[model samples]
Target: MNSKSHVPFIRTVKISERSGKDTIKIRIAAFVLALTAGGLFILFLGYNPLELYGTIISGAFRSKMAFQATIRFMIPLLMSSLGVALAFKMRFWNIGAEGQIIVGAVCASYFALFHDNWPHFLLLIVMFAAGAIGGGLWGLIPAYFKSKYDTNETLFTLMLNYIALHIITYLRDGPWKDPGSSGFPKIARFTSNAQLDKVLGVHFGWIIALILLVLVFIYLKYTKHGYEISVVGESKSTAKYAGMNVKKIILRTMVISGGICGITGMIQAAGSDMTLASSVAGGVGFTAIIVSWLAYLNPFGILLVSFLFSVLEKGSSVMQSTYGLSTYFASVLQGIILFFILGCEFFIRYKFVLTKKGGK
Candidate 1:
């Protein structure tokens, strides 16, 4: 034993870039693994996975009404996700979309509540503009700090969301409280003039969302600004070497991101709620981050992923009714899926290998 015995083997992990097809395969594998894991949990709870999955599919798509409801849910998610995608593309962590949405809706409500005397088209125009400006300004604040002082945008934007929520709460409980609702805290609903028209049971906001999708796709694919954003995202040093205005780019990108998010809030107010409230955004702003990442920040990919999430959201209610389970179970499933998706990236980028003790 003292005469130079050799060890068996050793292992080490190495990182490597994966091909496009391999990346897609890994993602698919992660998805399957997540579903399998979820099924195991369902089995442990004494529920039939096949039946539950079938119910989800049918609830989301079997009936015209069900499909329409899913579509309605998809609209805001799609728009908000696209908005988040814009900032994410440039490595900007804009976590304040929730707050930006609230600000936009609040600004738009100013017109709907008091300026109802204006022509319908004019009132709508004002609301849209107000929403965009309000959101853009909110987004610009974080960008300014990040550019000037290198502030942590994640915290700044996140804190802003709480502020926006408080603002809505104050407005609802104090100034904008509907006097007609007895003691209940409420904001006044918009008049018909301030509402969005529907075509075939879908609000015109769907049309706007679709148009923005195509525009965003084109902007990222073929525009010079999009290329500049790509360069900046890859490396600020490279962008600077290329003579790009980094600070201006940051501000401009955030404005676009926040403006789109604001429009989503306006659509929610005018097209769905027809009133402003703390829950007007309905958590779409936060959900949009998941949507954007799952879609790899591609506009068309966002649309597809948004639709899938909408199906889960719409179908989850049915699951609660049929299985007597909490609707939050759907959220749990989504979290599991995302967790696996993110975990799979590690395997895609790295692998462990075993070798002889003295092997290179």
Candidate 2:
């Protein structure tokens, strides 16, 4: 007599032909599931999930002031995401937006502190240009190393962030320290000429951010340089075979990327902070990475995601004030929501199949 055995086997399969409708449906499902999970967490904390959700919505849009605040929060995040999207489109993994932003702020502040006698518009322009140059140079360092030595850009860029941060510390405690402050280490505030004027109720950074959105969209979708970046991102060998100068492309793209992020730093210092500080970046550089990925590296998508994230952040603050919840709790809620939405991408691209096997 022969013995037979049966077993179940599982295999992962890629879904290469998903439609737009299917993708939307999966995302919707993931969002609903995330809400459910977050609701349960709220329940466990002895809170009404529905009420909390409503609070979040109203808090972000309840008044003109609230709306303005949300826009303010969105400005740097939107700008930084746009910068990161450009580099990511080229598959460069430029994680040094934080460093780039810091250096830009430092450069902008130099003009703000010393060149206050210039006309207001001229001063602002000079600061902007200085910031762009500063950030571009800072970003170019990693790109040069990567092109020459094939170094790991991710780590290089990340390490640069710490160095840039320490630069601010050195300035505040050393050369740039305010002599007027009594025993406190801080930089001097910018003069009126260096400050950004308001358009509605908020600073004009929002207007700049919108302009950048259109520019980046057109740049990525229509221009030759954008096309070259896409080719390089797909395959360097193919790019080289197509007669494209891959090294030049890498260097130029990073300059643009870092320049945009530098503008973010300039805006933060001049438009909001009115002074450069270590907190000027405020993790906006890191948060922009999440926004860039969530938006699929599309400039328009980045705008939408950045707005949504701004709302989440502003609303979370309100939730904390209203419910007396700890900041960590709000962060956990945000993390839970993000995890579900991000995890859904895996399902959109792949699926599992089970098969039965028999042996004798």
Candidate 3:
């Protein structure tokens, strides 16, 4: 449908460390540029940009519930984004994480559906294993094809998204439909013991997510495999030439990426939603791409940017009704923001000058 939310096909570029300053400047410039674009759009639509933004600010920050909602939204997005960031760092495109999350959630749901009476400890094990295995399998499909037949992973993974959506829809409507409900769409409520704990009105998934950030950070920084990932991502041919097992690393890193995404799905099922539905994943796989990009492939940066996205998303509803701003306005804002960020990269990498090198 090419909605305004559609992410453009941005070729991955591994920026050097030297560009860190440029990255900061880009963030500043992108904010300014996005604001300008948003203002112009609001004027064209016969609305005040100031009013729209002010409403969003109050809506997003005025209440504790809004803050909790923001954390809830950020946690899964951060999880999925971390997965994507790892894959992107390795030069592997995991566009099917959306599908992988569904695979994980669907599998976790089944575990609880049947093992509802198992002890909490054993049930947790069963759920996590199912979720990890499910997402890993989903990831393997694309990796297998890419590794064996040199297939285009981008297309392969994109198609998997729809396949997964249909699978969840079928399960909820047919086999797993709650017996007492007439037309509602959802599975039986999941077992309570299988879910993550709520911390101060929020899920412990956020806490786990933060711990993962540190672990993944250390994993990539100090481990030999992380070194190989960077090397292979830099050049597969070069990696192979240097005695690194290119194929093994590809499969293994992807498994890691997929496994984490599966955990994200499990959290959504166990901690947040407590059941399987067509909307279980909430398009998180796609949004994670934005998070990864904004984080500049830095896990710590992903953590902060994720929370920022949460605010905008949760605030959109307020903007919609409080100021009569359409939902489309949110999409416009994201687009403009992304545009400026992408454009800023150009300024960082190259400088414009006249052919004479002096005259304008």
Candidate 4:
């Protein structure tokens, strides 16, 4: 007992390589815990947590109109999350989805505004093509720099988002500004032919989202390029050692990522907004990141997460009106859920150990 009193117990955390099943269990548990915590917060606010949750579910699903609105919000989120998931699978941070979406919407609007007399189907095809090209090009920029010079893609892509926003702002305020508007800065609306029609109360994009989910799942699971992407994501050096074209893979992956986001933009313009605007993306680009991550980059899993997000978004209005909660409260709850889920990953990957001091 040399002058030091030995502590009876000491605890430390250590990493554990948990199995996939175990990880999934932890994540599910985390979700349940997060909801419980959120309910406590509601109770603290003097509201019945059960009623609030019931209202949220009913508000999002009680009627055809409410359900349709939820689907409407889910389309863009599903598409955007799919796009973000594609790049995330390759470990490339393509955060410029906002800019890509803006570029896409702008390109689609250009055609809609100038070629309104074109055949309806033809214009639709061309508009979609223009959006994909614009977004692909914007995504290509960051990839080119990263592949050629090892630039930081996170910042580059993020900065490009603002650049794309300003570009749309200029168009809305200047050349493309609607003269018919009462001096308000707004882009001209697309003609009826250029706009998308509803199918059973949902836009046709819902079909596209479903099809893409299947295709993405197959592509990732059964393709050579997909294998290459997995290898590169696991380790670039290993990919290079295996003779894979790492740079080409990165460039190609980003294009697909950005191109998908572009399609999402076109959907926004043609299916919903029917016009281009600086706020066209609606921050869905960032939200898509959360969706993609929460789904662990699983294409099918994105559908589930996207629907959950849509419920929160659509139900927020109900909360605001019925319970006098701030409209942003939904966002706050969503953030807390995400935080708890992510933090749970830490516990999933590690465990705490307690031992007597000075004991082996």
Q: Which candidate is the best by lDDT?
A: 2
Please provide, for model 3 over 80-148, each residue's C-alpha lDDT reduced to its tens digit, 9 standing for 90 to 100: 898888888888888888998999988888878888789886887788788888888898888888877
The alpha-carbon deviation from the true structure for residue 336 of candidate 2, after best TM-score superposition, in angstroms, is 3.1
TM-scores for candidates 1 onward, in order? 0.94, 0.94, 0.90, 0.94
lDDT of 4 by residue, 1-360 (tens): 676666547555667688889888999999998889999999999999989988888889989999999999899899989888888888899888888988888888899999989999999999989988888888999999999999999999999999999999899889898999885789888889899778998879898889878888887889998898888888999999999999999999898889888988999999988888677898999989988998989998899999999998888778778988886767677877889899998888677677854764
Candidate 2 colliding pairs, count: 0
Q: Which stretches of model 2 miss by more than 4 angstroms?
A: 1-8, 328-334
- Where does candidate 1 stray beyond 4 Å? 1-16
| Whole-model lDDT per candidate | 0.89, 0.90, 0.82, 0.88
As for lDDT, the candidate ahead, 3 or 4, is: 4
**Tens digits of lDDT, candidate 1, 1-360:** 675655447554767678989999999999999988888988999999878877887889988888988899899899989989989999999988898888888898899999989998899999999998888888999999988899999999999999999999999999999998877799988899899888878789999999999988988889998998888889999999999999999999999889888888898999999899789886788989998998989999999989999998888888988998787877788888889999998888877677755655
Q: Global CA lDDT of candidate 3, please?
A: 0.82
* Residue pairs that clash (backbone atoms under 3 angstroms), model 4: none
Worst 10 residues of 1 by lDDT: 3-12
Worst ten-residue run, lDDT, model 3? 351-360
Tens-digit lDDT track of model 2 for 313-349: 8888888899987655545665676788799988899
